[model samples]
Target: MAKIKDHPLRYDLVNELHARPFPALTVPCHAVYVAIKEAEHAVNRDRAADRAHLLALLDRNGSPHPQPDATHFSGAMGRHHLKWESHTEFVTYSAFGSGVSSRAFDPMEADVFPQDWLAGAPGTRLTSVLIRVEELPQDEAEMLAKLDDWFVPESLAMARVVDGAAVIAGDFRIDPAGHMRFAVFVKKGTGERRVGRIVQRLCEVETYRAMSMLGLMRARGLSGKLNTLDPQLSQLISGMNSPDHSPEEVLQTLLKISAELESLAVQFSFRFGATEAYEAIVTQRVSVMREVRVEGRQTFGEFMMRRYDPAMRTVKSVDARLRGMAERATRAAELLRTRVDVERSAQNQKLLESMDARADLQLRLQTTVEGLSVVAISYYAANLLAYIAYPVTEGLGLSKGMSMAIMVPVVILGVWAMVRRIRHKFH
Candidate 1:
């Protein structure tokens, strides 16, 4: 039997599931994460430049380069482990070091990413996060006390995740170091892989949340534009009901409104869509933790609902309003077109009526001219006949006056008969 052939993408497809594996993390470790995205037109940016930038960082560490077309990479950079992943519109870098700094949440923890190398990045930083993982204390009370010292009591959201194998706490606030902070406490005997997964989830929640808010910022900028357009559109739509404006004029205004709205929609379409996707991912990453309340503390899901959900809602509301305005403009344009067509038909009808009246007047004038021609011809024929009958009257001993009288009626009858015959032949 011939061997079955494999599909061309079979290997790639299967390997994708295992790609970007969770980092195997031990206790007393720290991680710093950064995401970078282009300031403008990020989705269509030169991706090769991003890859080159990644290569530059790897070269600085004397590390092996990732494959030419690779989207993710993992390597050792001195005392830290570097992991990089490229996304549709951005890129992320994370570095894990084996031990925490002497000062908790120290500003220097971010030094895993060299300052000079970061300055050379092709894009701006979207967000940066610092995460710390430590072994649980012998007593649970000590861990709770540490959480209080590290995070704000009012804003802290601590939970027992991974079936209580670990506890996670974060205030979701930026520290003086300009980075969000997260802390993980692992239960004794908990595997390193599980702890790593929890830390990764924390990084993702922060990263995706920041990314999602970009959409909100874009929406807020567009909101001012929408405010200007809304009143203009409403004014134009109201003009449609006015009898003073011509259909053509109203149509012109409607078309202009439609065009401007469409242009705005095109500009912000991708940002809004990307925001929605990132929001869902943020929510998913938070929910996947299966977080349960730890000592009745707030959870990540609740914090997002309170702080993040409102921003997402604003973007959605603005997006919907834009669509509604476009639809209204379209409907108004159609109505104006119909009105213009009806007015044109009425004008054509008036023109046709005037033409009919002109034709009737022309027919009457022609009949009067024909009657005059008949009278003039008979008079000339009578003279000619009277002259010819003169010689005959003398031979018959008749007077010229008598002869003329007799010829007058005979000539008139002859001319009238001749005119009738000619008119009948032509008809």
Candidate 2:
């Protein structure tokens, strides 16, 4: 029996699921993470540049290079192990090293990503995060005391996650050093692999949050543009029912307004869609962490609800407003088009009626001209017949006057009959 052939992409597709493996970290380890993206058109930017930059970092650390088309890489970068992944709109690098800093969430601990190397990045930094991971201390108040000094009290979100395996905390605010901070207090006896998963989820939550909020900025700008169009569209719609302007003019204006609205939809469609996806991801990442409340402290989910939720809602409201306006413009344009067609139809009906009246007048004039032609033809025919019969009548002792008089009626009748025959054939 012949062996069955394997599908070409079978192995590749399966491998993809396991490609970006979660890092295995023991307690008392810290990670420095940063996501970089272009200022504009980041999704479609030259991906080769991103790869080259990753290669540059690997080269500096004397690390083995990843495959030419690799989308993710994990290797040693001097004292720290680097994990790099390319994403749809950005690239992220996480440098994981053993032990936490004595200064709580200190910036100097992130020296794995050097200043000069970060400056040579292919894009701007979307977010830079400093994560401090440590085993839970014996006393809860000790952790609480450290948190107060590390993060802002008003914005801090702290939670016990993974069924009390760890307590995670972050302020959701950029520090003076321009990096966001998170502290993970791993419960003793949690597996090394589990610790990595917790940290990974934290990174995802922050990354997606930042990406999703981009939509809010776009939404604000869109509101300004829509504000300008709303009044113009309203005027055109109002003009549709007015006698001051013609239907054609109103329809033209409606068309322009509709086109403008459609253009805006097309321009922002991808960004809005991406925003929604990112928002869902952020929510999902936070939910899976299974956060439990820290006493007198807000959980990560609650923090998002109070602050981030409003921004996402604003983006959604703006998107909805844009759609509503587009729909309004479309309905108005359709109504105006119908009105223009109706008016043109009325004008065409008048034109057709005038043509029918002209046709009737022409037919009457032709009939009158035909009658006059018959009379003239018959007069000449009668004269010729009188001449022809004059000789015969004279020989029969009949006068020319009687001969001409008798033939006149017969000649006129014959001429009328002949004309009728010719007209029937032509018709």
lDDT assessment of candidate 1: 0.87
Best by lDDT: 2
**Model 1 ranges off by over 4 Å:** 363-427
Q: Tell me model 2's lDDT, rounded to 2 decimals.
A: 0.90
lDDT of each structure? 0.87, 0.90
Across 1-427, the per-residue lDDT of candidate 1 in tens digits comes to 9999999999999999988999988888999999988876658556798889888887777888888888899989878899999888789999999988878888898987888888988889888899888887878899889889988898998888878888899998888778988999888888888878998889888888988899888999999998998898888877777889878887887898899999999999998998899999999998899988888888888888998999999999999988888888888888888888888999989988988889788768866876777678877887787788778899999988888788778777777788778878976
Clashes of each: 0, 0
In order of appearance, the predictions have TM-scores of: 0.85, 0.95
10 residues in a row with least lDDT, candidate 1: 38-47
Give the Å error, residue 89, model 1.
1.0
Q: After superposition, how far is residue 98 of candidate 2 from its true place, in Å?
A: 0.8
Q: Which stretches of candidate 2 lie over 4 Å from their true place?
A: 383-403, 425-427
